[model samples]
Target: MSESAGQPASVALFGTSADPPTLGHRSLLEGLSRRYPLVRTWASDNPFKSHGAPLAMRAALLEAVVEGLESPNLRVDQSLSSPRALDTLERAARQWPEAELVFVVGSDLLPQIQRWYATDEILRRCRLAVVPRLGWPLDSLQIEQLNRRGGRVEVLPLQIPATASSAIRRHPDPQLVPPELWPVLLEQNLYGLRSCLASRPPLR
Candidate 1:
C-alpha cells in the first residue's frame, strides 16, 4: 500500500477461512507466486458465514495444503486477524512497511468490494488481485468503475471451478478441493459428517 516512490513492491496477500482450502485456491496461489516475490496467506473465522470448523483444524489443514504445493513464495500466516482486508493490510504495514500489499480475492467478491466494511479505506490501502470463478463472469465495465473509484484491480490468468466451502460442507467432493488435503479432511471428521470413507484411520 506504500505509495512512496522508493518502497519495495512485491508482496501479495491472500486470506481465507482456511476451512477446506479448495483446488481453486491452489490455482490462485500458483498464479500469484509466478508474479509476486512473496505471497502471504492467512486464515480466520468469517463472522459473516455459518459456523465453521475449529481454527486450529483449519490452520493445520492449510499448513498441510501449502506443504504439498511447490510455490516457495507462498507463506502461511496463521496470525492475521480481524478477518478484514483493511485490518490485515494494517498489520502488514506494521510488520513489513516497505513491501507493497495486494489483496487477492475471488471474482465473486470483485463487484462487492465497494460495499464491504470500510470500503473506502480498503481502496486506499492496497491493489486487488482477483481470481476467476467458473460460471461467474467478471465485467470489465464494473472493473472500470472500481478503477474510477480509486481502486487498482489486477485479474490473475486462471479459471477455476467455483466450489465454495459451504458447498463442500453440504457435500464433500474430492475433485472440488485440493487432492492432497482430501485424506486430511477425512481424518478430521469435519463438516458435521461421519462417513465411513472419512472414518478410516490415516495411512501409516
Candidate 2:
C-alpha cells in the first residue's frame, strides 16, 4: 500500500462485530487513522457467528467509541455495515470513488477469509490489510494461500491490547470497554454487565 504521485488518498475500511466496542477497537482505529488518510469503521454481523446484541445497538456503541477517540481521520459509517465483505467493499467503492480502499481485518479472522463469499473478487477490488492480534500470529501459509487466490495482503505494523469482545461478553468487565459505554451496558443489561458495575456510582 505505497503512495505514488497523483494517486488518490488511501482509505482504510474496517468493520467489526463490535458487540460492545472495546479498548482494543479504539487502539485499532487510532492506529489506522495515523496511517491512512481516512479510516471508516462500522459494527457488523458475522454470518458464521451468533450475536448477543442487536446490530443497531452494536453500531451505536461503536459510534460512541469513535466519538471518544475524536480523531479527525476516523469515522463510524453504519451505512457500510454488511454481513458480506463483498457488499461492504461495493458500498465503499461507491462512497469513496476516488480513494484507494484497503479492507482491514484482524489476523484472528485470517482463516475465515478464504471461506467468504466471492473471496477472490473481494480481494481483487481492495488491498487486504491484516492487523495482527496479540495472540494470533500471522501465518505465512495462510498469506500464501490468499495470494494464490488473487489476494494482495499487507500485515499492518500495529500493536493493540489483547482485549476481546467475547471475553467481555462472558465476564462483563467494565475495564474492558470505554467509560462512555458503561451507562449503556448497565442500562441495557448487556452481557450481564449490570452486576459488574453495581458497586460503582452511576455514570452521567
Candidate 3:
C-alpha cells in the first residue's frame, strides 16, 4: 500500500464492470480490505463498453467473490453502481457522510479519467488510488493532468494479476476466475462458457 500525504482515507471505493468477476477482482478486493478500513465495490455499467452479462448477474458474481474472501472490511454494494462515476461518488458520500472516500481505479483508466462526467468535481471530492495493472504502465503526463484537475492520485503498490475480464470473455477459461463463480457461469451459460467446458480434457 502506498501512503498519501494526508491522513489515511476511511474507505476505498472500487467500482468495476465485473462482467464475470475474475480472480483479479478478488485479489484487488483483498488488497483493498487490508489497506482501507472499509472497501466498497459494485458491478457498474460502463457507458463506453458493452457488457456480455446483465448487471444483476455481474453484481452477483462480484458478491460471490466477496463472500469467498469472508473479509469483514469488504463488501459488494450494488446500489452504488452507476454509468457515471460522479453519481456513484455522490451516493457513497451520502452513505458514508463522515468517511474520507478514495476513488479506486485501475492504471488502465488513468488516461480516461479526465473525460469522465464531472471529472473535476469527482477529483475534488475524493482522492484517486490507481491500482497497477500488468500491461498498463502509469503515465506521468496523465498524472500531471489529473493533478492539474485537482486530483490527489496515489499509485498503490499492489500486484494485480495479468488476467482480464475481456480476455476471459474472448476465451472463457475456468482457471482464470475463482471457483466460487464456476457453478453460476456454467449454469447460466455465460460468456460462451459451455463450449469451453466441453472442450476441456478430463482430469487425470
Which residue ranges in model 3 land beyond 4 Å of their true spot? 1-9, 201-204
> Candidate 2's C-alpha lDDT?
0.88
* lDDT per model vs. reference: 0.75, 0.88, 0.88
**Sliding window of 10 residues with minimal summed lDDT for model 1:** 195-204
| Displacement of the residue 144 alpha carbon in candidate 1, Å | 2.2
Give a tens-digit lDDT track for model 2, residues 82-192.
989889989998877767889999999899889889999998999999999988989989999999989899999998999999999888888788877876777888888
Poorest stretch of ten by lDDT in candidate 2: 1-10
Q: Give the TM-score of candidate 1.
A: 0.84
Report the alpha-carbon TM-score of model 2 versus the true structure. Answer: 0.92
Native-structure RMSD, model 2: 2.9
1 or 2, greater by lDDT = 2
Candidate 1 lDDT at 25 equals 75
For TM-score, the strongest prediction is 3
lDDT, candidate 3, 1-204, per-residue tens: 215533334889999999888889989999999999889999999888999999999998899899999999788998888988888889998887777899999999998988888999999999899998989998989999899888999989998888899999888787788878877887898998778878887322
